[model samples]
Each structure stands twice: as C-alpha cells, then as structure tokens.
Target: MVLMLGFVTIVAAALAAGYLLGRLRPWRRAGDWAADQVRFTGAWVRGGVVRQAVVVLVHVVTAPRTSWRIMRTPAADTTAPVPVRDPDWVAHRTRADKGGTP
Candidate 1:
C-alpha cells in the first residue's frame, strides 16, 4: 500500500509540473534567449557566476579577431585576358545574306 501511494504521488507531481510549464509557455518567447544567455549568468548558476561572466567576456572580444587572422583573403587579378575573336552577330543583321532566312 505504501509503495502504491508513493508511485501515485510521483505521477501526480509530474503531471502538476507539466501543467504549470504548459501554462507558462507564452512568456518564454518574449525576447532573444541566445542574447540574454550570453549577456548574463543563468539563475541556475551558483558560486561560479562571476568566473563564467569573465570567461564569456574574453571569448566575445578575442575569438572574432583570432578567427579573422586565420581567414584567407582573395588576391586581386591585376590584368584581364585579351579577347581573340569578334562576337557572332547573325541575328542582328539588317538584311538576309543571299537567302530569305536571317
């Protein structure tokens, strides 16, 4: 009887938590969560909150430059290739050459 009661209580608690989360779903989309997560420590963070903030700050500033330094830039092509032949102009001729077809 006690085991059955304990199982019932755990299932009831799970359902209650699920119901509460479902009711609060609309409030979750109020802002960009990625930006917020980057700017500040999560409420779940306990003693190491300040250290997390410093590490995230260092990443934000230095990582972009380090990535840029590794990137390769395209070298300019200084000269254009010389054209060898005249373009075909068969359609644009004002008169047909010897035949009725242009």
Candidate 2:
C-alpha cells in the first residue's frame, strides 16, 4: 500500500511538472495563438453541430410530405397546392374505416 501510494504521488508530480512546462513553453506563450486555437477548435465543433442541424432541417423541409418546395431549385409543380392534412378529420375517418365503414 505504501509502494502504491509512492507510485501515485510520483505520477501526479510528473503530470503537474509536465503541465507547468507546457504552459511555459515558447510556442504556447502567445496569447493570440492560444486565443486563435481556442476560437478555431470551438468554431470547428460548433459549426459541425450547427451544420448537422442545418442539414437535418433542410432535409426535413425537402421531404415529400412536407412539400416545402425549394426556392434554390426548380419547382416540381407550378400550380399544384402543397398538402396540409387535417389531423382531426383524418383520425375520424381512420376510426370509421376501422369499424368497417368508409
């Protein structure tokens, strides 16, 4: 148990020393470099997450049922109105059909 404790203490000291050395390193000294790295890394991850959400949203808008036709691309039909299902009526009809009535 004493040997294990000594080993743990040595490892912790080494890690702390290494961390201090990295902080004092010449390349890590520039405030702008650190700021730029932080900004760039943060922007990369943030943009990735936002980009994913945009892709999903765009896909949802472009889905067949949504009929949210794209203005970026050519329209599928110039005159056909987009479908907007009435949920209450649809549910009522579904119940009637299930009871063997149209």
Which candidate gets the maximum lDDT versus the true structure?
A: 2
Q: After superposition, how far is residue 95 of candidate 2 from its true place, in Å?
A: 82
Q: For each candidate, what TM-score against the reference?
A: 0.30, 0.26
Counted clashes in each candidate structure: 0, 0
lDDT of 1 by residue, 24-57 (tens): 7633432234235443656525537785565445
Clashing pairs in 1: none
lDDT of 2 by residue, 5-89 (tens): 9999999999999998888875434433433433354543466777545444544443533324432557456666899887787
lDDT of 1: 0.57
Alpha-carbon runs more than 4 Å astray in model 1: 30-102
